[model samples]
Target chain A: DVKVTQSSRYLVKRTGEKVFLECVQDMDHENMFWYRQDPGLGLRLIYFSYDVKMKEKGDIPEGYSVSREKKERFSLILESASTNQTSMYLCASSLGGGPNTGELFFGEGSRLTVL
Target chain B: TQLLEQSPQFLSIQEGENLTVYCNSSSVFSSLQWYRQEPGEGPVLLVTVVTGGEVKKLKRLTFQFGDARKDSSLHITAAQPGDTGLYLCALWAAGNKLTFGGGTRVLVKP
Candidate 1:
């Protein structure tokens, strides 16, 4: 079975602390994405990587950054965590092309709480 | 403003009852998809509609795309407790990305 694994299932951090969320996929997909989900806002994309070392900002990339140094690994970074950044983070991987051509497999999600 | 709007933000019904959720967008889309997210899991793709006026059925669920490509609907017949979850509608937007609606939270009681 295909799998997308998120390193942390839950995390608590102090405001202004640096944070890292790691994701790994076993499918060898070419496209990987990071999204933050909130109560009323739904899931907003933070960043997506289409290839190793290649990344693109999504609709809401304000306080977040991503690294994709390897094909199967994608990491989300919060330089200085803030209360507003507290949200459920999801990682997903998809076979090349786009959502129209294939389905996106998502990880279990990492819930981050900032104080 | 949200690119896509979903009606009936929350729904609670007894088992065996029928329910329908609507997703509307002022802007036409080339394709649309529906996803379901459970309590502690990420969203999972359920169905994708490409052609206008397309209808797809998955067991007790039925999905329909508007002929104008600006709307879609998901209907559940004889819903069970397992059907309870957050239902989201998404559209294929420019930049090869997907924009999702706020989502409809459904609760089915037995």
Candidate 2:
């Protein structure tokens, strides 16, 4: 079984604060993603890393950045958090190239509250 | 940008009832997937349908892909209380990206 672990399950931060959310996958998958889920709006991608030191922005990447210093770890950074950034963050990983590449294994989401 | 529109944003039914959730899109997709998410947890992949007009079954759940690959549907038979959750349809687009629908929240009462 693949395991994707998130560093924090819950977080609280003030506005304009810098926030860091870490994710680690044990399956050694090459693809990792960050998404934020909000009511009515659904889940929107924040950023994704295809390999170590490689990252790409997703649909809603504003006010967010990502770091992929290692193959097993991908991090999401909010340079300056705002109340609008408060939501559930999810991390997922998958095998890089194959017919089943779209199958994503996700970690328990981290709920961040920006006050 | 490609978009997936899911119907019946919310459903409430008694146990042993049958229900279907639909996902429609104007843009063509290479493949589509279904996922179920519980509260406080990330979504889990339920099934993936790639071929046009293809159908797959998992227990009492049935998934079908449109012949044009632009839509999909999930049907649950005799839904149980344990089946209550959010059902989401997603598409695998170019650049290895997965776009998700807004999801349908289902509640099954005992």
Candidate 3:
């Protein structure tokens, strides 16, 4: 069974505070993603990385950035958290890139509350 | 970015009942995926439909892709309490990004 582990299950941070959400995949997958799930907007991708040091912005990357310094570790960083950034954050990894890739293995999401 | 729409924002039914949810898009897709997410958990892939007019079944669940490859449907028969979750539909777009629709929240009462 492939496992994607999220470092934090829940976090509460004040506005303007810097925050870090970490994720690690044990399956040695090549593609990793960060997404924020909102009530009526669905899961909007924040960023994705296909290689260790390469990252790409997704549909909703305005308030977020990502780092993939290692093959198994991907981190989402918020330079300054705001109240509107409160949401459930999810990390996922897949085996390959492009249209023919396999299913995504997701972590138990990290719920962040910005006050 | 591809736009996908899921209908019936919420559904509630008793165990042994049947329900169906839909995902629609105007743009043709190379493939579509269905996922089920339990509370506090990330979405899990249930199935993928790649061909137009394709039909696939997993146990009591039935999935069908529209003939035009622009829509898909998930039908569950005799739904149990374990079936309660958020059902999400996603499109595998270019660059390996999965564009998702607003999910259908299903509650199956036992």
Best by DockQ: 3
Deviation of model 2 at B1, angstroms: 8.2
lDDT per residue for candidate 3 within A28-87, as digits (tens), equals 999999999988678989999999999999988988889999999999999999999999
Off by over 4 Å in 2: A98-100
Model 2 DockQ (Cα-based): 0.59
Residues B1-110, model 2: lDDT tens digits: 33989888999999999999999999888888899998878899999888999999999999999999888999999999999999988877666678789999999999
Taking the tens digit of each residue's C-alpha lDDT, what string does model 3 give over B56-100? 999999999999999999999999999999999998777778889
lDDT of 1 by residue, A45-84 (tens): 8999989999989999999999999999999999999999
Of the true interface contacts, each candidate retains a share of: 0.52, 0.46, 0.65
Fnat score for model 3: 0.65
Q: In angstroms, give how far residue B44 of model 2 lies from its true place.
A: 0.9
Enumerate the candidates' DockQ scores in order: 0.66, 0.59, 0.75
Q: Each candidate's TM vs. the true structure?
A: 0.98, 0.96, 0.98
Give the winner by TM-score: 2 or 3: 3
Candidate RMSDs in Å, in order, are 0.9, 1.4, 1.1
Q: After superposition, how far is residue B43 of candidate 3 from its true place, in Å?
A: 0.9
A48: Cα error in model 2, Å: 0.4
Backbone N/Cα/C clashes per model: 0, 0, 0
